[model samples]
Target: MVAVGAMGVAPAAEPNTQVPAGSRHYAASDFPDRIVASPAQDAATGFAVAWRTSTLSAPPLLELALAGDSPDMGRLRQITANSRILQSENGTSQHHRADIDGLQPDTLYAYRVQGQGTWSAWNHFRTAGAAGQPLTLLYFGDTQNKNLSHVSRVIRQGWQTAPDARLALFAGDLVSGGDGMDDSEWGEWFAAGGWLLPGMAVAPAAGNHEYFEEFEDTPQERRVLGGHWPVSFALPGNGAVATANTTYWFDYQGVRVAVLDGTSALDLGTAQAQAQWLDGVLADNQQPWSIVVVHQPLYPLRAERDTSVLATQIRPVLQRHHVDLVLQGHDHTYGRRADDNAALPQYISSVAGPKQYRLSPQARATMEPVAEDTQLFQVLHIDGKQLRYEARTATGRLYDAFQISRDGKGRKQFTELREGRIAPRDCPRPVSPKGRDDRCWE
Candidate 1:
C-alpha cells in the first residue's frame, strides 16, 4: 500500500503487490478515510463532518465528546451517519456524513467515525467563539494539479503558520478533474491535507473544474455539478433554492463568509438568483466583517479570459454591501488590487497549486505586486475593527502584506504593508504549453 504519512507526504515506493499494480493511495479499504470537518450555519453551537469508506453491510456512525484529559468513553455521544453510495471510475464506495450539534461555543471536541468494525483515529476541533471575538483563518487558492506531490507542502506550511486557525477557506478548483469521476484525485487531495483537515472547519467554493461537461461534442453540451461535491461536504444549505449546497453562507466568530458557485452561476443560468440571494445575505449581515469567496474573479488576470458576467452580476452586490474582502481563484497566478473607489471590495486572486499562468498586460497595469510561478497561501486575522492580512510563499516567505481598518461608521481604510516585501516573481515571456517556461523566476 502507498502509505501517506502524518505530514501528508506520500512515500517513494512501488504500489502494493496485493492490489492491482497501478493501485496506489487512492483505493479505499475497509477503514474510513477522507475525513473532513465543516462549520454549521451558526458555527458556535454546531459543525458537520464527512468521510468515505468501502461499501459496508451496515451504516456508519460518528462519536463525539467534549475534549478532556480523561478517555471519557462513557460520555461519548453516538450520531448515526447518513450514507450514500457513489460509483466512480475508481469503483463504488459509500460516503457518510453526520451533522453534529448541541456543541458549546469556544470549546474543543474530539470526534471519530466508525466503519464496519474499525474506527478512525480521534480528531479534535475547536468550535467558533461567540460574537465580538477575534478570528484567525487560512485562505488557499486552487490545489488542482500535483496536489499530492506539490500542493501538499503549501497546505502543510499554511497549517504550520497558523495552527490555531479556526477555518481554512479554499477559493476553488480543488482538483483538476471537474466530474469527480476520477476518485483518485479526491483521494490525493484529502491525503495532501492529512490530519489538518479534521482539526479546522473547511469552506470550499465550487470552481468550473468541479463540474463536468455533459453531452460533449454536441450542441447540447452543458455543465453538471459533480456527484462527489454534495457527498464530500455537508455545507450549510442556506443558498438559493436551486444552488443549495454549492452556494451558501456561514458566520464564524465576528465574520460572515459567503461562498458562491461561480461555475453554476455562469453556466447553469443561476447567476441572477445567486446575486439576489447574496444581496440579502450581505444586506442582513450583523457581523463586524464580511468576506466573499468565489472561483472566478470579477477582474480576470488571465489574458484570454473574461469575467463580464461576474462583473455585471456579482461585483455590484459586493460593492453595494461594502464587503471587506473578496477572495478568488482560477487565474492560477497571484494578483491583488484594491479599487480606487474605497467603497469597492478588495479583490485578490491567488493560486496554491503548481499550475502557473502568464499575467495579462492589463494585469501589470491594474494589479500591483503580481506574481507567477509561485505557490502561496494567505493568513488573515480579524479583530474588532481591523483586519491584518499576509501572503506567504510555499517556503514560508512573506510575499505581500496589507491591513484594512473600519471606522465606527463602517468606512474602510486600506493600508499597504508591502514596503519591504519580497520582490515580485514572474516570467518575462509567456508560459509554455506545459505550464512553465525555463526562464521563469520565482
Candidate 2:
C-alpha cells in the first residue's frame, strides 16, 4: 500500500487487512465488470473501451454497430482487442482494450464486450461532432474511499446534476490503496460507477495512492505507479515516455482536456518532460476552452503542503496558454482559491469520498466557501465563449456557483454569481478513544 501524508491534518489510518465488502463473484459465463470507456484522442472519429474478466487467457472480442431502425444484429462488426493478464489475490483476470475507429462524426453507436462464454449487455455511446458544439462534463476529486459505497452516492448525484455529461474526469486516487495487492478495491470502485462508465468517456490522473511499493533502490516511502493504472484504463498514449497512459490529452467538441500525472512528475523523474509536454499540448490547443486535470493542486489548501514545484513549472504554461479551468484533488477538502490573479486559471480542489480534513486557519481565511466533512462534485458546461461551473454536495445541494465568459473585446470576465449557497461545515474533530473512528460520514 502507498503512504498518504495529510500535510498538517492528521488522517486516521484505515484497516490494512480489511478487504472490500460486497459481491466478488465472477463465473466463466458472466459478463465483465470494471468496464470503462475512453474518448478517442479525436472523439469525433473514434472511442475506446476496456473491461476485465475473471477467466484467464480470455480472447479479446468486441462487437459494435450503428444503432438504427431495423438494425442487423448479424451484421455487427467484431473487433479484436489487445489483452493482458493481471494477477491479484482475488484471482487472475484479463484486461482487454479495443479502440474503434473509422466512425462517423456525431453518430450514436452500440457496442458490447464478450468473455469466454457470455457477452455483456449492449451499451450505446454518442460521438462528438465537428468543432464548435456545447459540452458538459463531470469532475470528481479524490475518491479514495474507506467504503466504496459511500462515494458511490456522490457519483450518482453528479450524474443527476448533469445527465448529458459527455465525459467524467477523476482527479486521481480512485481507490484508497491496494494498487495491485487487492483487486477487490478496483471492483468496488467500478461497482460505484456502475453502468455510467460505459456510456461516458473517463479521463483520470494518477495520484500518490495509485503508486504501490517502493521504486528500485529507493526508500519504501517512495513508490512507482501500479501496474493497473495503465492497463485498466487505456488512455491516450500521447504523453511523456513511461507515463503515456497516465498522462495524456483528448479533445471533445470544442474543449481540450489535458490530464497530467502528478505522482510521476513530482516524485518520479518525469517532471521536466511532463512540463515540456504540457507546454507543447497547450501551445497547440485550438479549442475554445482548455481544461487541465491533475491530482495534486498547484496552490495546495493543506497547511504543511507546498506544491511549489508543480506551481513553478506547470502553472506558467497554463497561464501562458490561457487555460480556462484547473481541476484537481488530493487535499481531501473542498475549497477554491481566492487570490485575484487573473493570469492564472481558476483553481478548484474538492473531495468525493468519506475522508474529511479540518480546514486550516489559513485555508478558511483565504479560500471562499470552503467545506469540510463533506463530499463534493463539480459540473462544468461550456458553450461558445461562456463557461459555467457549479460545485454541489453529495445530496445535490448547491455549495458554490459561478460563470466565466469572454467579452466583445476578447477579455475574460466573471459574471452571474448564483447565491443562496449553504455555508461550509466543519465536522467535529477526532473524538474516538482509539482515535481511528470515522464520524464525518455519520
Q: TM-score winner among the candidates?
A: 1
TM-score of each: 0.92, 0.89
Q: What is the lDDT of residue 297 in candidate 1?
A: 88
lDDT of 2 by residue, 1-442 (tens): 4445667545444642245444344312246767899988898888899998765454768999887666565578899889887766566677889999999988888998988677888888899876667788899999877535577899999999899998899999988775433566676778788878999888888898888766556555676677677778867788877577688898888888899988887777677788899898888887778899999988787778778778878887888888878899988888887334673477889999877665667778877778887899999888777888899999998888888887756577776465868876776656432454433432
lDDT assessment of candidate 1: 0.86
Residue 336 in model 2: shift from native, Å? 0.8
Can you tell me which runs of candidate 1 are displaced by over 4 Å?
A: 1-21, 178-181, 428-442
- What is the alpha-carbon RMSD of candidate 1 to the true structure? 5.2
Per-residue alpha-carbon lDDT of candidate 1 for residues 189-258, written as tens digits (9 for 90 to 100): 8888998788899999989888889998899999988888889987888898879969999999999999
Candidate RMSDs in order: 5.2, 5.6
